[model samples]
Target: MPKVRVHNMTISLDGFSAGENQRIDAPFGDGVGWGDELHAWFVEASRDAAAGKTGTDVDYYVRGDENIGATIMGRNMFGPQRGPWQDESWKGWWGENPPYHHDVFVLTHHPRPKLEMDGGTTFHFTDDTPERVLERAFEAADGKDVRIGGGAAVVQQYLRAGLIDELHLVIAPLLIGRGERLLDNVAEGVEGYRVAEMVSSSSVTHVMLVRR
Candidate 1:
């Protein structure tokens, strides 16, 4: 069966997954700037991957996309836009071709027409609950794993609902005083999951949690 997984989610030492005061200019917010320090390892790994290099710890983290058939993310992760559709001009943070080269379901209160990008990526906006969205995503995923790409709140929603099968968190060493935390108000919390793997790197610690 296809599992719902979260991969390469970077969080700070103080448990902030995203900094406060998010805007168009500051997508990840003002304080941490999309947790650059938190995602440095993956950035480097991505560069190496582009250069045809592999077998590094970062490579392992980057490879999680190989089995993903579709992705689910919050509107925040899509862009800084809020409320009703200001205009259809705002496609997303990513350029013409998004990194997610597959079906990407965006959770939002407002509805929008399906967006087709340069790559195989297509954005489908929905105002449904996590469970309903998951069902749709699974249908879109066709038997492959569905990845939950988030901005903390969306991940917490699914986590609380006990819908996530695996979670891969990259814990950076730095501490952001305040921001959106991933594990906050997560029902019974991570008690239902167990640490399946832990590896430490110079910039971050990779931890994989598998549902029991």
Candidate 2:
């Protein structure tokens, strides 16, 4: 059985995933966001690219995972800015190409045409509910896992629905104080998960959790 996994997500000591007023210039928030802890993780994740390698952590995480067939992300995670779709010119923040090579489903209130970028990445916007989007993504994945590449809200939906199988988080050592918190106002009686493993690198502390 393929697992629905969430990985490489960063959180503040206070549980804020990202700071408020996030923009193209300041995606993660202003100031020493997450401090040195997050900088190290970012450096390592992009180390291969920094070393001039063709692959990145994104590739390594998805590659060879026979159970991984598709990805689901929020509209915000797909690009910058918020609110209704003003135009279609905003291709994405990633240069001419993006890292996602597989089929990706995006959750959005507004509908937009699918975007096909270089390197085999395609974004499909869905007006359907989260469960419907998950179903579609899983079907497209062909029995493989579906990664929830989130911008907090999307992850929260899945978490609330108990549709997630694994939770992988990287705890950064900084505090946003304000901004969107990952589990803010979480509904009560939510399922409890057990920490399965943990790894601390010079950059970040990676924690893995499995539904208990």
Clashes of each: 0, 3
Candidate 2: C-alpha lDDT: 0.74
Q: Give per-residue CA lDDT, model 2, range 56-86, as digits (tens).
A: 3434333323356788998888777677888
Alpha-carbon runs more than 4 Å astray in model 2 = 32-39, 48-67
User: What are the per-residue Cα lDDT tens digits for candidate 1 across 144-201?
Assistant: 9999999799999888888899998888888888878888999596778999989887
How does residue 166 of candidate 1 score in lDDT? 94
Leading candidate by TM-score: 1
Compared with the true structure, all predictions reach lDDT values of 0.86, 0.74
lDDT of 1: 0.86
